[model samples]
Target: MHRRSAVTVAVAAALALLVATLTVLTGAYEITPGGVVSTLFGGGSGTDRFIVWEQRLPRAVAALLVGVALGGCGAVFQSVARNPLGSPDIVGFTTGAASGGLVMILVVGSAGSQSVLVGTVAGGALAAVTVVLFTLRRGLGGDRLVLSGIAVGAMLAALNDYLISRAPIEAAETAKAWQYGSLNAIGWRPVVPLAVSLALAVPVTLALARSLRALELGDDAAAGIGLGVTATRVTALAVGVFLAGAAIATAGPIGFLALAAPQLAGRLSRAPGIALGPSMAVGALLLAVADLLAQRLLSPFQIPVGLLTAAVGGAYLVWLLTRAPRREGARGAR
Candidate 1:
């Protein structure tokens, strides 16, 4: 990694730690930073330990991991599509996962987290297959993949709305809450699995980063250099799908982290192509900050973190769109 990129990762990691500390200390019981550190290392009071371990720490960890997962996957998606708008949120994987969870919640009425998880994973896999099937003949690159994903995502989104509308009011309420995507209900059960999944997937993503970069030189040039264009692209896509799927299953599809994290990371690092490590770090920081704000923004009320991300993400999308023409013009002038 470049010195600047490494520095970006370090700064993001430091900020994420600071925000997580704040999150652990911000509850009504009010523990000191020292208390939090002490509690983490098994030296604090029982109540302090309970609050930190049982409540706040899990939530904080969830935010960080989900951010990492989304950001890494977002970077992969953009690299594969060769477009900044190619995040999972745009491509439909998130909506598909949400649809699965909604199906379990509304139709099957499965209250168990395992059932919801299975539904989400299955839903996400289905969406990936749908998009790939559409673009298989043309291959997974450039505008084709992005367009197929958009179409799949839109149809799935409509299906989600229909499922919610047809369900009972109580079920509909539950589904709606899940759709908004909050880290509020997160605990060790979910966080542990998410962490494990990322632990496995992150290395695979980083391993593929070199090939993905070469792919930017176009399929013909990549093949000329002995790169297996189709296989590498598919593998990268699968890894991206897994990362996004795992995150959506764990966190209920938090909006725009997958969309914005990689873009922000690229700008911050100023490195060629998507930097997965920096993107993951940036993602972790972004979510930690968002969760902190969500908790403190309403004080005792404590709104969902998803709403905050969506509001910010919407603005980022607009900025990206307006900036694109200018970027293209600059390239033309050069």
Candidate 2:
């Protein structure tokens, strides 16, 4: 709770709120400003009620919560790995989860179902196991794990595309929407499981933040200080895998939020290392805005929010690579 961290949280909260408000106000079926307020409080025309309560409100809430989960886990992975590049996307969890959900969507033909969620989490777990098996050949090092994840992720990406190509035309189109990280088909029904999962995961991650700090001192130092290095790492890996799986299950691989949120949060909060609170808030802010942009950019034709974030993240990646100190490359790649 540094003052800078507090300030960053407040600012991100404000931006998230503003984005939510704008999202409600903007859409295909326009509702007047006063109408939106009245509708929110249980008094408006049927159209306004349906659009606001039944539609936009749930979508906005889902986006916010998903961002929170992604952002929180992003901080966990980055801090645990001791490098900013140590995110779920880079670690292969996202690709695994996506591959699972894609299979459900294409082969099983369940786009947004509880079964699809199960498949995703299961796929992600398997992918995580595979990466760990490969990396654990020598020892559990973040660099080795990341390298394994990248390779696994590339293979999974191909699998995902192949599945899509083999799908029926209609199913292909349906899976295509999910693949883009679009929230077009989401409703309040699916939000329950997602919200519940995030609620369960958040407190655990927050509790582990202190252990993460100690672990940042390296395994020997952490163990000397009486922290259970193995258990801590295992718990963190579980948390990151679960978070990334839930996110992918809900939104289908919304890239770069995991990659960018923690680093940006660290800079904004002026944290000694990485901070989870600011990262969650920043993630909510980024997603809220991205979802808004996704709706507005194509107007009648909504683009996927993932596309927008990927574009933004790509630019940020370029800046990061260019601005990073040369010596850090060896350390980061490790």
Candidate 3:
């Protein structure tokens, strides 16, 4: 198992590197990998150097950071919720974060990164807390919790739409870009906060990986083995919120990567529980690939990265619903 795990990690790392390379090399003014490397290292023509270093590099880095944050957060949530269906995308955390972002952009007229990050974190954290509090009475188990999360997500989405409707035409147009998610206007400005947040949160996530494993057991069983169920759940939720909020702040709630990456990692790892390392890797790879497609698919008129992810993620969700087993638990939790 250790050897297999190591091999999986190696393969994921290689894939992430390959995807990053492709993203850098396949843009409009193509450059060889060596040229890309030299341009990044300050040894190329003015335009080539500027495009490589100033334009694409930051976007690539943003994609990688967003991927890691989403993937890691997804694994944490899925484990704590003890449902394969549990994810920010499924439970309304992403929607809440996006709503928070829209509020900052439309109502407050603040498009600053810190303002958006603060609002997004607050929104996502509140949503997570609400989900846990409302669903805990009958115990967090199976499809009931997932169903409640879905309902909350839908409500938050409706709220998002209402806010969009009330805004002025200009604000509404700006919010539309956010709603679909995009990496176009992003630069190094937003990257700093996301890097800091990920630096702090990633360590916490790795340290808690074992606890997340225990969480996959029911709360009672986890408590029996000396885990503080409430504390662990809250800590994990906080990490997830931080990650989702940061990603939304930086990249405008890129859809489905968070939901799909962790599940894909778990399957690839063949682990009984969530796999954080692999999930982060897969998430990074997915975003890199998605961004590559978004940039190249329409030439001068690029598609929003969020739209590409949603299309892929939405299709994956449909496939999941068809494959998911019917639950035998109580319909709604008290």
Candidate 4:
């Protein structure tokens, strides 16, 4: 890696540490870093043990894993689609995942991990297919693909809201939380699948790193260089969709991290190509910080982490639109 990439990674690692420390030490049961360390190694009081092992530790790990997945997925999508706005949330994948989870919650009356996983995967796959079909005619230009995704996403959003409105009061309440995205009640059990997925996906993403680089060059250029444009795009999209769906399975539609992380990392690293590694690190950092804020900012009445992300992401989106240079092309209908 270049020195700049190395430095960016180091900075992100440091930030992750700081956020992790803060997250562990700032809760109602505030424990020292030393105490947290000792407890993990089996040398603390029962209360400390319970707080760290049973509660905070799992939550912290979940934040890290979720952040990494969202960051990686977001970076991949942005790179493949060649559009800053091409994220799971923008393209309907997150909404689809949320819709799937809601279906399980409302129709099946099941909220188990497996149910959530299945629903999210199904919904995300459906959205991915819709996006691919809509954009395929012109072979995935940035603006065309983004507009198609937006249309599909809006339709899914409307469907999700309608379903939520029709559900029973209790189901509505449950679906409401899923819509906003929360990490509450998550434990080690669900972490296993997340870890397994990450382990499976990261190496593949890294291996495709060079292909992604070639992809940054337009399709014709990429093909000239012996890269299978269609295959590369499909592989990247699959990885992104799977990661996003898994994330939704674990923690509803946590929006914006996927969109903002790569942009933030790009700004931070100032690298030639998209900063995938740094973005993943920054994404993990962002989610960790957001989760920390969600835990403490509202205190006893904890808000969903997605709400915090949405607030930050919405502001960032406004800034991007204002600052981004306008292009004269066939603009899609709003």
Candidate 5:
């Protein structure tokens, strides 16, 4: 890694840790920093232990893990598509995962976390298959892949709306809340699954990072260098799909963190290719801080972290779109 990239990753990690510590201290139960420390080390009273260890800590960890998962997925998608707008949020994978979870919530009437997770994975896999089929003829890079993903994502979004509309009133309400992407009900159950998914994904992503970089030079160039272009693209997509599914299963498809993390990491580090490690660190920081603000920003009402991310991400998208031409022009000039 470049020195600046390493420094960016380190700083983001530090900030994420600080924000997570603040999250642990900011809940209604109100443990002091000292109390949180003592409880973490097995010294505080029973109430302190339950509040700090059980309640607050789990939420913090969930935010961090989910952010890491989304961050890595975003880096992979953008690299594969060779487009800045190719993150899962725009590409339909996140929407597909959300649709699956909605199916379990509304159609099957089994809103249990595990059932929802299964649905998310199935839905995401289905979406990946659909995209692969769509792009099989034209291939997986440049405009074709991104356009196919956007079309699939749009259809899935509409399907999600239709399902919500047709559901019973109570179930509809529950489904609507889930659509907002919350970590409020998070526990160790979801966190463990997310961690395991990352453990499996991170190594594969790192191994393929070289191939993905070569791929950025175009498929012919990549293939010329002995990279299995088709195989690498397929593997990267699978990893990205699994990461998106696992994250949505854990936290209901928190928006825009995936879209913005890699772009921001790239700029902060000024790194030429995808800054996967820095992006994950930045993602961890962004989501942890967003969740913290979501909790404390409005006080007693408590906004959903997804809504917060959407609001911020929407603005970021607008800015990115406006500047894209200029950025592209600059790149062409160079």
Candidate 6:
């Protein structure tokens, strides 16, 4: 299993690197691989500088960062929930962040991009807390928690629809592409906020990982082994929500990477539970590749990255659903 995981991690890293390279080279105004390398070192032609530095680089960075964030957040959520299905995308976290982003885009039209990110953070955190409060009766890591998240997410999605409907056309127009999660209009400015968010969330999550492993043994066993079950759960949830929200802030809640990446990583690595590092690598690869496709799939008429992810992820979700029961039955037999 260890050897398998190592190979999986290596392959995932290679894939991410390849996808990043290809995304940098692709667009309506395509740059050669040689040109992309030169542009990164500040030696490309003026057109390359404007398109590569000002346009594609930041978008690519945002896609990569958001993917990492979602991947890490998904692993944490799945661990906390003790279910493979527990992901920010399937739960309320993404919707909460989206709702907050929509409000910022529509209601606070005058506020800057910074405000939009803040709103996303607030929305995601609030939604996570709300889900916790409602499901605490049954406790975390239960089917009840998953169902509650689905419920809350549905409600927030409805609110998002209503908000979009009531907003001015201009504001709604801006929100429309965001609603589907696009990396079309990114820049260095947006990258700064997301960087800050990741810096804050990632280290904290890593520190809690040992505790998370302990908690997987169950509260009684974990506490007996010196883990602060309640505190660990809270910390994990906070970090997970923060990462998910920040990703949404940067890229408008691109879904399924969070839902799918960790599970895929776990399977590939033969992890008994979700593996964070491998998951992040897979997610970065997935979104970067997805973004690359989003730009070139329709060529000059680019579609939203979120739209493509949604279609693909919806199909993945269906597959997971059908596959889950058989896996569970096998485990039961074991």
lDDT of 1 by residue, 181-269 (tens): 89885779878778888889999999998899899999999999999998998888788878887887777889998899998898999
- Cα displacement (Å) at residue 234, model 1: 1.3
Distance from true position, residue 304, model 2, in Å?
0.6
**Is candidate 3 or 5 superior in TM-score?**
5
- In candidate 5, stretches whose alpha carbon ends up further than 4 angstroms from where it belongs are 43-46, 328-334
Query: What are the RMSD figures for all models against the true structure?
Result: 1.8, 2.6, 3.6, 3.4, 1.8, 1.9
Per-residue C-alpha lDDT of model 2 across residues 1-334, encoded as one tens digit per residue: 7789889999998899899888987788867888899889998988889889888998898788888888988898887767677788888888898899988888877766577778888888888889878977654556787788889989999999999999989899878888788776578877888899888988898889889888888889899999998788778888888888888777778998888988898988997756888999999999998998889888878888899989999888788878768657778988
TM-score of 5: 0.95
* The 10-residue segment with the lowest total lDDT in model 2: 135-144
By summed lDDT, the worst window of 10 consecutive residues in model 3 runs over 325-334
Please state the error at residue 118 of candidate 2 in Å.
Answer: 1.3
- Stretches off by above 4 angstroms in model 1 are 41-47
Question: What tens digits encode model 5's per-residue C-alpha lDDT throughout 1-334?
Answer: 7799899999999999999988997787766788788888999899999888777889999999899989989999999988989999998999999999999999998877678878998998899889879989988887787889999999999999999999999999989988899988577877887788889888887777778889988888888989899999999998888888889988898999999999999999998777888888999999999999998887767899999999999999999999989988999999
| Best candidate (score: lDDT) | 5
C-alpha lDDT values of all predictions: 0.87, 0.84, 0.85, 0.86, 0.89, 0.85
Error of 2 at 327 (Å): 5.7
Residue pairs whose backbone atoms clash in candidate 4: none
Which scores higher on lDDT, 2 or 5? 5
Residue-level error in angstroms, candidate 3, position 296: 1.3
RMSD of 6: 1.9
Runs of candidate 3 exceeding 4 Å displacement: 30-34, 326-334
Clash counts for all predictions: 0, 1, 0, 0, 0, 1
Model 1: how far residue 62 lies from native, Å: 0.6
Candidate 2 clash figure, as a count: 1
TM-score (C-alpha, index-matched) for candidate 6: 0.94
